[model samples]
Target: MPIDHKQPYDESNIFARILRGELPAKTVFESEHALAFHDISPAAAVHVLVIPKGAYVSWDDFSANASDAEIAGFVRAVGETARIVGAEPGGYRLLANTGKRAGQEVPHLHVHLFGGQPLGPMLAR
Candidate 1:
């Protein structure tokens, strides 16, 4: 189920577990402030998730609390992850579900990078 974006960050969240090396993830890229990995259930031909290293519950929380360096690093990491997934050549889309209403499943803030084929409309009408 989706969760409230304002909910407290769960240390044992799946992503956190993956970060702590207590769970396995198909990692694609890693930097000081972020980690990019293949989504277990990909939504497109190329699907990867990039998340900041900080304990942020949502974009609102992240923007309010993360250091400038952390912000820049996470942004760069997402871009690099897109490149690593070979999506730059074909174009790509970045999606972040901020709250339960937006379909956010994990409490941790994460961006989904999607590409490898035409993604069609930005939103289904």
Candidate 2:
């Protein structure tokens, strides 16, 4: 059987269209590895999504297949984007939801960087 490269039982990925520019986004920072944009449905004062340029099924799949450089570049981009969004000094939260169990509505692997105010808590289970 062919491996389903498509995300299993998840909604359409946002990063794909953001890469294609099909959807409008407020991009703060970008690199070869990832792109950072303000979340359309923001949960906090400074809510941004740091997404890898390549489409991955989820965080686990991304970690398994992504190269060292790709991973490093992504991490660096996150820090840069955080500063751009003014989430560094005030502190921020990086969130990655993997599956439905974890409230991952979008299948594409991404890190949500949010701050600029006091976050009540991480993800509520």
Each candidate's lDDT (Cα)? 0.94, 0.81
Ten contiguous residues minimizing lDDT sum, candidate 1: 81-90
TM-score of each: 0.97, 0.87
The Cα error of candidate 1 at residue 103, in Å, is 0.6
How far residue 125's Cα lies from its native spot in candidate 2, in Å, is 5.7
Give the clashing residue pairs of candidate 2, or none: none
lDDT of 1 by residue, 1-125 (tens): 99999878999899999999999999999999999999999989999999999999899999999999999999999999988878998899999999988889999999999999999998877
Best by lDDT: 1
- Candidate 1 TM-score versus the reference: 0.97
lDDT of model 2 at position 60: 88
Residues 11-110 of candidate 2 have per-residue lDDT tens digits of 3456677688888889899899999998988999999999888767677888888899888998999999998888899898999877766667666788
lDDT of the structure predicted as candidate 2 = 0.81
